[model samples]
Target: MTATTTVTTTATTSAAAAVTGVGVVLPGLNEPGGLRHGPVAGADPVDPAALIGKKGLRFKDRATQLGLCMAAAALTDAGLLGPRGLLVPGDRVGVVVSSNLGNADTVCRAVATIAEENTGALSPMDTPNASSNIIASEIAIRFGLRGPNLTVCNGVTSGLDALRWARLTLRSGRADHMVVAGVEPDNDVTRRLTGARMVDGGAAVVVSRTDAAGAAAPRVLLGPSFRTEKLPDCVAALADAVPGPAREAAAGLWLGPDPSAVPPGGETADLSGWGDCSGALGLLHCATAVAWADSGRTEPVYALLGGAGGEASGTVWIPVERAA
Candidate 1:
């Protein structure tokens, strides 16, 4: 989402913010890494080293690998990963990633390894990957992104929060292009808390300022949080927020795991098919909304994310109109 002004109470921007490139790695659909989807929950481990084509990644943890794969995919899809260099200058681009459980299994195993062996045997490489913010740093290092790098470890709302931050960063001219990503891995901690095996996935999208939509790409969407409003309020806000062709889509879309968390009376997409994605669901919603808009059935689509915590994170996409 682009801002018209500084992200004050009523934010605006000189140019509209648009989602130019999108990448999503879903459960059982491993596009980044060549790992097959395991039966049921515990999928075969993904070796992202092969996907990333980097030698030093052997020591990095799974979450970090997942984050890299999604960021690379988004950059690739955006044509930013050209043979020459990044689409934008390294210093002009930023990376923001969010996750609920960051390095859970890594810390658990690190302790087990130290206990089983000793301090001398403990690997120094593993220590750096244990932090929650390592994912963004790793991506920046790999791509030489010298702009702002942020990692959010908040709960379910973290993904949305990351997107919000990216919006502000662009509005403030800190970066010309921002890659916003969200990834969640399956682990013991999440399984015990959710009582179900987590469906691991990573989703990423590139947000930038542009005057027109990419003809082959999906229209860039900008949201004013119409998704968070009540059905009546959402509908009313959407009337002003959406263009003529897509106003109805805003009124008809419903997203979230909890029915009570959102206003009633819209076509609720079945998220059960995704199993348990944990906090990555918020990013998934953003990517899905963009893809759905690409399908020509919708534009400037709106989506709402609700967690078991009963809190809602709503987002809107305002599609960039094609140049005449």
Candidate 2:
């Protein structure tokens, strides 16, 4: 399909501070079942057996496990514990997750069951988890979220699309708090489908309305989407608009060749890995920005995310604010 661009921002940021929490979930692959600390921008390789134990989670698929793990981590990052029971009961909380290849394991198992049994009878367990909505459904059930729930599968822009949709829902007064996540599991099928070049991982972020002047809130900045075909070109545009220091501290440039090669006026702090999961890359950028802001540095932060369809998408800037 030919790529297209759509831009929408809410002029009204006064809807009871819509989102109060965010969560991310990732799956364990092989070894080192956690985030790796390095200059690479991609996810750390994880051994499923080590992280979840051999018999601990035999029934769940890789994506489901990843989704749950990231969701729990995001809740902790947002300083919330089981937000379903809290967060102004009945105050609409939405869950939006992005995945390009959804539930490959379940699909494979279902097909296998049919072949082995030599009949149309499919495994009941395999059928439910096979849908792309499984991750969204699991998130809803785990957190008791009863608002709008959606699963986006837009090539590489799924994560950013999910965030954009969640923000729109909040601004439209559809929900109060939304949990948006980008998750991908490692499987032979997904690897072949998406041209697997990096390990599997997931990340999530909570976007909510905050008073511009609130002392305890995260630095919130909004700008038009950066549209471009090349990563370096987009970074240059953002650098010109945002301050230099902020650009320097960018956790990682999502696109482009080398950080050092950036023009004289455009110097990025460091180069994280590249092209882990296209859907989750935007969330990873946001998460990195938050980490830098939390470090007490006064520099501005910008996250640049682009998709394979020659589409450039990113937030212009975000400032740090202490929560009230």
Candidate 3:
């Protein structure tokens, strides 16, 4: 199905982007079960344990497990049993994943082994896992996604950049289906390099063209032509432009109180994670969406990404009818 793509900028909304579905997954870690202040009056708190794997297979590395788990979770959340039956053998499926430091644990171990004076030859089996594309390649192999598969490492903006590429590819008919993923694994090097406050997680979303005739459509909505600036400026602009209720709601998720309660340009969410692996923040955003599903809220999700080059990109997604 071809979509009448539109890119508009106005005082009310920046742009209109499109998305079919989204899914989020996080690694098992010790964390508080509820939000800092507990659930909203009528809303229930999301159980972090239910979204992660407590125990499982041994051979898979942390990155691989994170990527796979997020992919599966996204598919399940989109109500797709399996793509094998739905997608044709030759159908174009694309994957765009972002990570800042890929497999630091494996690389460290390999280096350590070589440093050992009496250590034997380095393990050939461990080499491939050290590659940055390891996680992306694994997903492609498992899902048979043969279209454009890209791995971007642009710091915190990595995830948002991946999503932008996927959106454009689908709109241009480069791929009929696309999976955009953001994943990171916990490692001593990463912890030390970016400090120990960062969180490790993964999130993936299956985006496809909306079926015009379908009865049940995806709830996520996207917008085109996103604008992004520095963190402070972006926050200020959003605060001024977004409706009071929406701003309040988003602030409640990222901050302890409503956005209006704080200074207009102050940071809301804990962005320390961005310093370590900003790409993983995409997963956190996905998790927030999943947790907010019960609220019956309908709004286009705006993803803003900032990187080392002072480059920033914004993208939006809109929910549409699901395919059978």
Candidate 4:
């Protein structure tokens, strides 16, 4: 049951990608009804039922499962649930995977097998998951999508950068629809590498041309202005590039090691619940924004992400009219 949306404002860039559907898999809030934010606890995110086809999950690893499930949820939410959510033609749909340390456990397992025996010892089924790009490849193969597939390996703001890239891809006339995912599956390897309260699931968003904004209004307008940089610098940069909306009760994000210092004139979404989802954080932030906007109690939502070395990224969300 996809909600109807309507965009009131005229197109700003005329080629920006409109976020038609958003799916977030935070184990912390895997309720039956819909995705929502909750208090932060040292816990793993639970996957939804029937998240993917049995064949798809047959030989895939946990990282693959997380990504597949999120992609399904996003596509379904977008009202594109045609034979595993491939409503558009294959080539017109692209997939971009963003992650800090994508599928580390799979890579480590391959390396260990190689060290123990030899290259021949590595399982062919396990080898594909080792590559970060496999996440995107899996989505393409699952939904019969033949569009350009890419993987972005930035830092914590990988998801944000991926969204920017997806929008650019649409503007370039590369694809009619784009699926961008930022995934971080829980595993011992990730726990050791990063001491954050790793959530087991990830997040995905269905992107299309701004003309499709009405499909899922409360549109998150991503354009050339949305970018990843440093914290205060990125915030200041966004202020210069795109000014804040004229809505009251606006929401903003100030994410980092310590996100205590809120921005000057906007509100920040609570990221305490999902823990350090790493690559998945940006999409989680987006889910929070969409949920907040579509919840009747509308407000302007802004996504602000800060990474290591003072890197930051941001996006603007306007809940013009979201279905209840």
Best by TM-score: 4
Residue-level lDDT tens digits of model 2 in 22-126: 343343221111223333334455444554346434566777667766765565455443444333343366688887765876787677878889545875655
Q: How do the predictions measure up, each by TM-score?
A: 0.79, 0.72, 0.68, 0.82
lDDT of 1 at 179: 84
What is each predicted model's overall lDDT from 0 to 1? 0.65, 0.56, 0.54, 0.65
3 against 4, candidate with superior lDDT: 4
What's the lDDT of the predicted structure labeled candidate 4? 0.65
RMSD, every candidate, angstroms: 6.1, 5.9, 8.3, 7.6
| Better candidate number, 1 or 2, judged by TM-score | 1
Error of 4 at 133 (Å): 0.7
**Sort order, lDDT high to low:** 4, 1, 2, 3
Candidate 2 weakest ten by summed lDDT:
27-36
lDDT per residue (tens digit) for residues 49-154 in model 1 = 6566776578877777788888887877776776555756788789998887757877777778889998777678788877778889998998888889998766
Find the candidate with the highest lDDT and give its number: 4
- What TM-score would candidate 3 get against the native? 0.68
CA shift at 296, candidate 4, in angstroms? 2.9
Q: In angstroms, give how far residue 79 of model 2 lies from its true place.
A: 3.3
Can you give the lDDT of residue 104 in candidate 1? 80
C-alpha RMSD in Å of predicted model 1 compared with the true structure = 6.1
